[model samples]
Target: MFSDNREQLSRSSTFKLLLYFLACIGMIYTVFVHQVYLSSDTFHRKQLDRELSQETEIFTALAGIGNIDAIRTLIAEKQSIASPFTYHIQPISTQTASLSYPAALTGDQPYFELSDLKSGSSLLLDDDTILRIEINRDLLQKYREDLAPMMISGVALPVIVMIAGAVWFAVNIIQKLQRVNFAMNRVLCGEKNVKLAVSRNDDEFDILSIHLNFMIEQIEKKEASLKALTVGVAHDLRTPMARMKLRIESLLALTSNNQQQQELEACHDDLELLLGMFNGLLEIANLNSGKQLISKQRVDLTTVAQDAVDFLQPLAEEKQQQLILRQDAAHQLDGEPSLLFRAVINLIENAIKYTPEEGRIVVVIDAFGIVVIDNGEGISDLDKLQVCEPMYRADKSRSQSGSGLGLSLVDAVMKRHGGELVLRDNSPGLRARLYFN
Candidate 1:
């Protein structure tokens, strides 16, 4: 559902690592809080101990009174002062200790009171009632409120420091990046000697700077070589071109016979093809140098394919071959219209040249895609690999039909737009599919 964001992630490694550490801290702090300060049963047990002691003293006071009725009256009167203390009247026994302390005392409120038999001279509860002591769930909450902040502070401070440290490191990296970017800008603005500072950490940024400098060095070498080549070739080819032009003009003037005229026309054609090849080479260089930017817009592949097929129909008919056209998704795209049309035309023309008079050419177009299929003998895999290489041709003579640079030019055009020419075997024919975005 998503593209690889590895490049972006790599750029923000420090920030990502810091966030990871912060998340771990938060989790550990949460677990600590839950364990240390949030336990209710422990609170209940402690509260029960306190209640038990207080109830023992109260029962001792009531035990000295021998009148059971009088003692019951006094206990009833004091019930309000002893909240959460319960008294249950039953046959009290040593075995009842298992039922134990306050039966309903929660963690917060411990249930504790007196009970026993008067016969033993011990107040059953006061004169013959049993008492139970226990703690309840409320004691836990009471303890939690008192200790929660202390526990959180103890845990969260370290975590907060760690998070802040991560953020600080990220900010440091960002500041370093800004400085590096300023240096790069100065270099781009003609300060050729400007270079990035090398960091000693041996991290990815250090590797990137080293590689970038190496690339700049290579580019400088290539640029020097290209300049020398262009100047040398211009000097060499200029003389030959001028001499050929003079010879062609002279031949036209020296004879008006049909035979001489045909020869001169052929000679001119050869020189013109040479000029075209050189011009094509220059265009390829322009593409490689990124001087030519493609206009990126939604282009209708169907419309472009149909137009190409129509342009080749007359040629196909002259060759006694049928040209079939099919198209889909007539949507527009971000592209150079003239360049795209020229590319399509070149493919169709190439197919026509290879196709026999009785053969068929099929042109297909789908939304944002195109394919030109032909019923001519297919190209072998080895030949297909080099088919788009400049000046490379499987058929050496080219039957005096094409300059042998057509596919190469087309490949260069599509590549500039981030597209490619896919050569596939179409059974008895060759299929040239151009995929574009």
Candidate 2:
């Protein structure tokens, strides 16, 4: 779950925005620290350098005046008072060094070793005596010690607050987007009434929700208008088609001319096909409009599959195909028995219509759903995406005799049952599954 959440966050624009903000903050903080350290270091180093120069001049003047005793006494006084300075005196005639320097400063070091926490200067007087003065960088150390906490709080506190705020903002934006996504998914699933929740703040997200709600409303209105028009046209044509079918049947009963009878029978069959298409359109429209309430009961899916197979077995056998059912146990779920049976029948019929002679068709029943697999010229990848639409016939199935509402009606039935019809490519065939929730 954590990994999934992390992945989602990584893909989120809000999270990316936060990362960019943090990068900028980090850059600013680095530059700020560098500048602060440079300014503080330069100030303290210059101050220490000036003090060292002054101390060296004082001792040099004493050596020039030949007051060596005064210089020695002053050095002794400084050592006794625990001053930060250390002194070293060397005479060229004696070729020996005075051991007055601190243990940490006993080397013949350069004038400035700032990194060693010490700075020094030396002068050669007229008496050929060398004087060196070194001072501990205690002031710089103190400044660093005092500035550490300030720098930490200065950068850390703001960073922490910004991170917290950014996290909250990202979460808020993601939640709003998720709600919108969920609503759109419901709409896609045929629930046109679903609407996004609008918050009272009227922020951008809320505005987006409002606009989406308006769009859904418009879509619902247009769909209702279209469905009404379709239903109306079908109803108007249905009566005339029924009359035509009856007339053709009457002519068949009256006239015994073989050719005329065959033509009339063909006309009757065409009329029946037209009537069936109209009825299917009306059924789908009623199902989609929620005007038809499904009466649900605990129905055994295996029995429904058995019924469909038994009904369609003769048709499959006529095509020299095998109709097989594989069910280990009875899987019972709450659904409309008639609708479930119709959906299964439609799927099996489509399989029989498309599969070649000597092909195999299997109906598998499980706890979750029913699957109908057929070894036929399967639907193309492109056609599978739109084959379920009303009156949409794939190129492969175009020459076949169908109004092209079989899959659409099955889809409607599944929706009415709160299930789904999923079509898959079974390698060399088609696999259709009816998944029930």
Candidate 3:
């Protein structure tokens, strides 16, 4: 069986355009060479005709002087020069003027002999003498040989210059594209305000930079507006919710029936949950808005990981799960200790909540980051992307009792410290990795 061996070619516009330009130059060179050949052929034919005419004038004048042998001698001398013409002289053989002519003039030779002039020229001399001259075909070959230097100078050199110019233009465009790509990548890597540098020339790349800067500006504006709206809404709602919680507690104190007391207690619990959700929203908003400043210092990740494990050990034991710490080396990173601690706590808590009873949770600290893993039902592939989004929880963890904003807050803290929180499968479990840079 034969295989389909198709592959994608380069999609760069600069490369494609350069290829097209070279093809055009090739076609133009073909046409130019054809025209040059035609011109050179005409020029050579004209030179041959002039040479024949000069020889004829000299032979006629010499014959007019009534010295036939002298004319023959002159023809022999002219033949010594490097010329395509060959001359022949024949004596009169008949008394009749026409009868004494060469066989070519007597209609004994084919018309092509005269038409192509390959059989030489024939001149009628005094005393019924005939003189014949023929042009050598090698002269045509010589014309072609002489054309090489002319074509190189007139055509090939210019084409080479044109191709070089096209290559330089393509390289310039590619460099501009590379700069644009670098700027976009920097923006993607958490530099929200970064934009392409614009020049005053207003060329295509400059125009592109202007557009990109405008787009980033609009995005930053919209993001700020959304954060402001979220914080405002959470703050406005929390006041009334707090008053409602106080009223419910007061009601619980005044209630006589045990049923009413239970209802008041449930109401208070609901209020507390709502208040906690609002607080989480506010915390994330402040972090995003750059209002939650971090006090960064050199902190050992091993200590942080160990402390988080120790703090959550009691909860892990209550569920009959193993909380273990594995440190390879003492790794230090510039970060806010309180924020990093909170992130570690969230990871460990999430691991404990998802892992089955008596499951093993491992906190591993390495040279670059900390990884909290558990031998539990890991998150599905579909939920991994949305895990950091606020209020996003895996289906298996939906039944557990906790706010879904734990990982979301942890993600915010990591970003605030210029780090990343990665969630992935640990083959048989989930691995939550925090990379500090």
Which of 1 and 2 is ahead in TM-score? 2
Per-residue CA lDDT of model 1 for 1-437, tens digit only, reads 01223343346877897788789878877787768664643665556656656665665555443344655665576565654444434544453443443333334323344433211112334323453433323544565676777777877787878877776677767667766778777755434555667789989888877877776667667865975596467557856876896789788888879998998988887777776666666666567557776666766777777788888889999999988988655556678777888889998998888888888898887764788899887788888878787677878656646656788878888888788889998888899988786
Best by TM-score: 2
TM-score of each: 0.46, 0.78, 0.77
lDDT of each: 0.69, 0.81, 0.79
Candidate 2 local lDDT, 51-151, one digit each (tens): 77777777766755556688889989988987667777766455335422222322333121111224676554333455666776574577678877777
Count the clashes in each prediction.
35, 0, 3
Model 1: per-residue Cα lDDT at residue 245: 67
Find the 10 residues in a row with the least total lDDT in model 3: 1-10
Segments of candidate 2 deviating more than 4 angstroms: 13-25, 28-32, 57-70, 80-82, 93-119, 123-130, 137-172, 254-263, 288-290, 293-307, 332-338, 380-386, 415-419
Better of 1 and 3 by TM-score: 3
Residue-wise C-alpha lDDT for candidate 3, range 215-256, written one tens digit per residue: 889988897797788789999999999999999999998989
Q: RMSD in Å for candidate 2, one decimal?
A: 6.6
Cα RMSD (angstroms) for every candidate in the order listed: 11.8, 6.6, 6.6
Instruction: Report the Cα lDDT for residue 428, model 2.
Output: 87
